[model samples]
Target chain A: MDDATLVALARSGDGDAFGQLVTRYRRAAFLVALSVIGRPEDAEDAAQEAFLVALERLDDCRRPSRFGGWLMTIVRNRSNNLVRREALRATEQIPFSARSSTPTPEKEAQLSELRDEIARALGELPEVQRQIVLLHDLEGWKHREIAQRLGLPAGTVRSHLHYARKSLRKLLKPGE
Target chain B: MVDNGSIPLELLDPGNSDPGHWARFQARVMALAGPELARRRATRPLTVGEVLASWWRLLVPASVVAAAAMASLLMPAETTPGAGIAIEEALVAGVDDEPLPAVLVADQVDEVAFLVAIEGGG
Candidate 1:
């Protein structure tokens, strides 16, 4: 079923529909939280909190069809709030895990290097650019979908994506 | 379509949120959701500040009306014929202005007598 239909059902107290919606958006929500909070456990907490909040305020959603973006906004807000509240305690780290017990040497080396450089670059990005980059590159969200979710124009999403990728490429250059 | 493939998709998805993790997360969320949903259904309790704010609205108008009533009760009586005359004004005001008309002379005497009775009583 479409998001609008599921959202409507959820608003009428359908727990199953809400569950389905949560399943569909949980990954995107996690990525959004991770982008802001920079820890897997904290990101999970923020994402779960966002879902709970979304469920409670489902009726306040003005556009149900854009539920993914709406949920992402909540995730981002919650994540940012968590970060602000724990700013002194938050240790800077890659947004995702880098360690793997077993992997080929070359692939592991590449992953290690990428994790370090990318984390620093991503941390340096403006929140909007980081969000657009993560949604587009990490989550495979299309520009139009991202635009709708972020309430930005498609052209702006594309422009931000281009600039973000360019910045990442420069920052991730070898031997820097 | 920006293809920087350093990060693997397998690392980001399909495995990070394993079924067990998803199940637990879902359960936790649903559990918290129960109270949140109930709280939304419940009426919000008003804070003391809010109660006082509402009372202030009613109190302001009621106080205004009460003050106006008190002021009216305490206002010196207008010195009209029907209104009770000011004692000082009756005793000394306009004493030399004119002689009373024949029809009003008796009434004037009665008013003067009443005023004298009040003064004596006081």
Candidate 2:
């Protein structure tokens, strides 16, 4: 069934509808959490919490068609909060990679050297810039959509994207 | 729509990259998110209905108390002390030792219409 149907059913005390809704979006929700928080466990937590919040507040959804984005925003905000807390911990740990676990050669080589480089480059970007890049390039969100979701001016979003990609290109250029 | 426009095509495409780029990303993403999902499930908060149910349970006793208070207010006052004493006294003095009090004055109770009629007849 469509998300709208599932959401409506879930609102009427149907647990099955809610379960279906969770299954359908769990992957994307996870990805969104991972990107924002950079830790697998934290991302999973954030995603699940977002889903539960969505379910609990299902009635507050003004546009049922926009439920996915609405739900994701909850995850994004929660993950961001964690990220901020960790940053305040006075350590510069990489997001999402295991703590105390060094990168293995095989794992490093799985992605093409350039792709790996680009990925690392993305990780290195400032938070807002990286978000802009990910929303535009990976998540396929339109600039306007990203602006609305991130609560930034469209021009600011475009500027962030422009600088982020340019900086990434320079950082990921051949031979370093 | 492979239009790179002014952008470099190489940035978007890695000729030697893993053939399963999307799949690999999907795996990493899921792995990273699994535990988060579990935590979220564990901490699932109460819904609106649950909240309302709890609230109603709390209100029921309050409503009952309020109703009792209102009923007490609307009821008539207890019998006056003087009237109660009169009834008890009349019961003791009456023929059967139990008065069927009718709330009558002392004059009404003392009336002797039958005695007066007998005297006139004589």
Candidate 3:
């Protein structure tokens, strides 16, 4: 079913419908938060909190059909708030010991390293470029869809995606 | 899509390699939001019928009071006993410009006295 139908069902107390929405948008929310916050752990927290916030304020959502964009706004706001709070706390970086406790399998460790490298590279890009690149490349969203959701022109979205990919390639392979 | 040859863009996707992670994430969000969702549902706007159904007990009596009030207002006012006589006496006195009768001055006019005063005045 479409977002509007799911939103209406969820509003009527259908837990399963809401669960489906969470399942569908969880990654998008997380990626959006990650793009803003720059930390996987903080991004996850922001995304989860955004979902709860969205659930509480579901009635205030004026357009149910554009639930994804609405939820993204919440995620972005929550992530920005987290950033501000973190700034107030003066915490600079996640302590290495705090990232993981148990040793990971070799393959998982390599994948984690690659993920961190990609995150660092993406961090070097402008915020809009990071968002566009992640949504287009990682989330598989079309440029037009991203434009509509972000309220940018489709050509601008495409241009950002192109520059973002170029920058990512350069950052990932400085040796080459 | 611009071809970023061997960019490993898929590696950046959390869901690509670890679907279970996202599943757990979804579950966690649902678990945390369960109460809020229930609250939203509980506080959902009442339909007109539901509102009437819920408040029918109070509403029914209130409606009765309102309707009785409206009926009373719409109906011609009822004159109290002797009120018409007092008004008629006042009108007669008013026409003659005689000293106004004491019944008109006093709070409660003695109906018999008032009739005698009216006869005497006439």
Candidate 4:
């Protein structure tokens, strides 16, 4: 069934319906969480937490078609909250898996640096700006949809995007 | 600034556009959501002990307060040589006059779910 139908059923106390809804959006939700937290385990934890929160408050969802964005907003909020509370703990540096022996260390090192730069740029954006960038550019969200999901005016979404881009531009400038 | 039908590519394009980014992100997402897809029901079933343990968290505190209230009721008059406040007398009398309330099973079930739900994943 489509997400709207599942959501309608879910609202009526159907855990099955809610479960289907979770399956439908879990990918986008996980990615959003990962994009923010940069730690796979923490991303998994935050995404799961977001799902639990969504299940409890399923009735609060107004437009069922907006479920994907709504679910994503939850993960983003949770992941950012996790990062904030953990004080980032340490820089999240995703090391190459020991199981992989394909790429040379030089190539792996460059990739790791790229990963760090991308994550650092993402981390430094203001909350609103970070969320907009992640949802729109990384997550392929449309502006109108983000505005609706976030309860921000369309203009506000655009403004956030503008600032987010400017900040990223400065961060990714050539040579440090 | 070249605009594609009023869409600014600079604004619209992914700053580090690798189109592959979405692909990898999607792959990881699918992996995460895979295990819990079909097993959505709360069917593991809360054991009686589990239920009571869950309930006791709230029940014990509420019971303590209630007991204290009941003890306060039965307490003797404070004005008398050994009597405590009227509230103490009434509290004791109330408990003695009545047994602890029924377990309130339905409300307790709801209480745990409500707690877990609002707090999100443990």
The TM-score of chain B in candidate 1 is: 0.35
DockQ of predicted model 3: 0.22
Clashes of 3: 0
True contacts kept of 2: 0.00
Tell me the spans in candidate 1 whose CA falls farther than 4 Å from its real position: A88-113, B1-20, B35-122
Docking class of 2: incorrect
Winner on TM-score (2 vs 3): 3
Off by more than 4 A, model 2: A1-5, A13-28, A84-108, A112-116, B1-122
Instruction: Please give, for residues A46-140, the per-residue lDDT of candidate 3 as tens digits.
Output: 99999988887888889998888888889989998998898889867632111233478998787666666777777878878988887887788
Interface RMSD of 3: 4.4
- Residue A41 of model 3 has an lDDT of 75
Judged by DockQ cut-offs, the docking class of candidate 4 is incorrect
Q: What is the TM-score of each predicted model, taking all chains together?
A: 0.60, 0.48, 0.68, 0.49
Give lDDT: candidate 4, residue A80: 76
Ranking by TM-score: 3, 1, 4, 2
Share of true Cα-Cα contacts across chains kept by each model: 0.18, 0.00, 0.53, 0.00
Residue B112's C-alpha lDDT in candidate 4? 61
Which structure among the candidates has the greatest DockQ? 3
Candidate 4: Cα lDDT at A54: 73
